[model samples]
Target: MTKDANAATQEKLGGILEARDWSRMHEAWHEDVVDHDPAPDQAPGLAGIVDFWKEFTTAFPDVTLEADPLVVTDDFITAVFTIHGTHTGPFQGHEPTGREFTVRGIQVSKFVDGKIAERWGSTDQKGIEEQLQLGTSDAQFVSKD
Candidate 1:
């Protein structure tokens, strides 16, 4: 892909991520976008992507994604980005934590014919873990064992 094409694709992802418009987000991805979670069962697909965003939205209804520069190879494209959000709802079986946080992450994507076909990513889990404990005595489990 040309530089312009790569840039356009990057911008598109930024837009979709920021908008959280899952209805049309799939169109931006390659038909076979891979979800590369630690568990294979959770790795890859349009449905998986949508599910992820749904959960993410629940965790952060007013979230926004900042797309980093895009790197393109003969077939794969990688983009580094950050997802920032305010935790105002329930997540991970936890009640409304009301914690605001921003997570930095990267997405390694494979594109076929200018469309994203696959992707693997890891977000700023450490930052999120810290944010989840911002206030309150929610941590009641104290086991010395």
Candidate 2:
């Protein structure tokens, strides 16, 4: 991938997150995108991304991503951003808590052709737990990972 191609892939990724376009995300991602689960037990892939976003974006249609600088290279890219959303529905098997939260995370993506070949990202686990009113020490979450 050339530098231009890299930048375009990065831009498209950011757009996917910003638009909350699950269909586009399914299209833009490779069948196997890697994710660095804060909960290490959770393996990462397209199914993980799709499941999380499908429920999250559905609950928070106003979810948005914000950031400034995005790194682009020949076949890799990274973006630092904050995702903001409100809890308007169920999450993590918990009932609505009606809480709003923002989580800052960074993602590095490997591109092959025009699609994301892989990805690894991290975000605020504590904040999510807090927002969901799930006890911080919930053992089920550990097992769920």
Candidate 3:
């Protein structure tokens, strides 16, 4: 991918995430895309991405996602982002404390035919736990295998 194409893809993804437009976002990914950081209940492929967002939005109804600069290369794009929201619903079996949390994360995506074919992500989970006043986060979103 050229630099311009990479920027376009990054912007499109950020727009979709900010709008929470699941349907359109689905079109941005390949059918067999893998989310390395999927939620516990999320299935494989696009369905898993949908489910992951569902769980997140359910917990933070007014969540805001902001994407930072995108580091682009020929075959991959790395996005640094932050999510801010109030905990008003269940999260990892913990009751809501009505507290707000700001979590930062990085997602690196590999492109295939101009669509995201695979992704690996890491988030500030400890920050979330502290903000929520939880001893530890038991959210089993990622695979152990």
Candidate 4:
């Protein structure tokens, strides 16, 4: 079960984030998946989640997420990750800044039948804004290779 959960999570992340395969989302997310921390103006359920990602990808076409070691227990998996991207399009009512940013985030997902049924998490939005507006760097927050 753990292996299944891990594989599902990996496939979900890779397919959506890396490959930009929105069509495969249904295979990894339950139809009624709950997001505990939905973004502002985001709707409900799987379609909403997909819409959110679509908008996000539009804003940062070259975005990438690098996750640290995951913590899995039973039906739950938690990951700490860093989001790297450049603001190249409109986002949250703000025009493009063309600035690169790195923001850290953590997400906890609950899997049911190998699909993500629920998730709770938050990212450093304030930090991202600072990087964009002030042209500050998040180098201090980045993980060492």
Candidate 5:
């Protein structure tokens, strides 16, 4: 792809997350897309991807997913991003604490035919739990990459 096409793909990817539009996000993926780092209890494919996002955004309606500066390759994009939001609903079996959290992460998306074919990511789950006053500070997240 040309630089222009890469830029447009990045723009569209970022826009889908920022907009939190489930349908558009699902449509951006290939029919057999694979998410290598889905949330607990999430299955595979576009159905699982959309379901995961729907539940997450439902709990954190005002969440912001900002794509930090990224590196784009011929068929992949690696991004560092921050997810910030307030706890106003149930999350991970916990009731709302009215607290806010900010977690940073990195994701690598591999594309095929201009659609996301696979994804792998890691996030600051410990920090998120701390912010929400859930698990102890010593909590850890097993590597998902």
Candidate 6:
């Protein structure tokens, strides 16, 4: 049961990303889905999910997410994915840098029926900032000779 649900959810996500279809979000997420780690300024529910993706795709028009094999247990599905994109548009109050970045993320989702009811996730924001030369981190790589 859980495996079937996970497969469906994965397929739906793939379709959504591949087509950049925000309208089809309801096919994979419950109407009142809870995102435990919502993006900054992202609202609640499925609409928030759609908005987040829309904003993300706008910022990184060629963004792609590649997931490792999913791990399913009970009603939970865990996915580790790599996100690759170029900063081609405004994002988070910063102008486009025209730089590319690759970051990793992990999400754990709880499925109810066949749709995602709740989720928690984290992405490597610092890595993105460093890659894009954004944010205020002053640390520099030094060689030990």
How many clashes (backbone N, Cα, C below 3 Å) per candidate? Answer: 3, 0, 0, 0, 0, 0
Regions of model 3 farther than 4 Å from truth = 138-145
TM-score of each: 0.75, 0.76, 0.85, 0.86, 0.86, 0.90
> What is the Cα-based lDDT of residue 105 in candidate 1?
78
lDDT of 1 by residue, 22-140 (tens): 78775567656655542223335677666667676777788876667657666666667677778888754557678787767777766666666666676666677688774433322
Best-fitting candidate, measured by TM-score?
6
Ranking by lDDT: 6, 4, 3, 5, 2, 1
Question: Candidate 4 vs candidate 6: which has greater TM-score?
Answer: 6
Per-residue C-alpha lDDT of model 5 across residues 1-145, encoded as one tens digit per residue: 5435655666785678667766786446776788887777777888877776777777777888777777887788888888888988886577888899998888887877777789888889888888988875433331111
Give the C-alpha miss distance for residue 83 in model 4, angstroms. Answer: 0.7
The residue-by-residue lDDT of candidate 6 on 36-145, one tens digit each, is 88877778999888887887888889988887867886688888888888999987777999999998888888888888889988888888988999975433211000
Candidate 3, after superposition: displacement of residue 63 in Å?
1.8
Show model 1 residue runs off by greater than 4 Å. 1-3, 38-44, 134-145
Question: Which window of ten consecutive residues has the lowest lDDT sum in model 1?
Answer: 136-145
Cα deviation of 131 in candidate 1 (Å)?
Answer: 1.3
Assess the local accuracy of residue 36 in candidate 1 as a C-alpha lDDT between 0 and 100: 56
Residue 32 local lDDT, model 2 = 77
Model 3 over residues 1-145: C-alpha lDDT tens digits?
6656766766776677667787887557777898888765678998777666766778888887676866888788887878788999887677888999887887888887777889988777888888879777567433101
Evaluate model 3: give its TM-score. 0.85
* Per-residue accuracy of model 4 over 1-145 as CA lDDT, tens digit each: 5766656665566666567777878877888998878877777888878887887888888988877967777688878888898989887677899999988888888888887888888888778879889444332221110
CA-lDDT, candidates in order: 0.62, 0.65, 0.74, 0.75, 0.73, 0.78
Clashes of 2: 0
lDDT of 3: 0.74
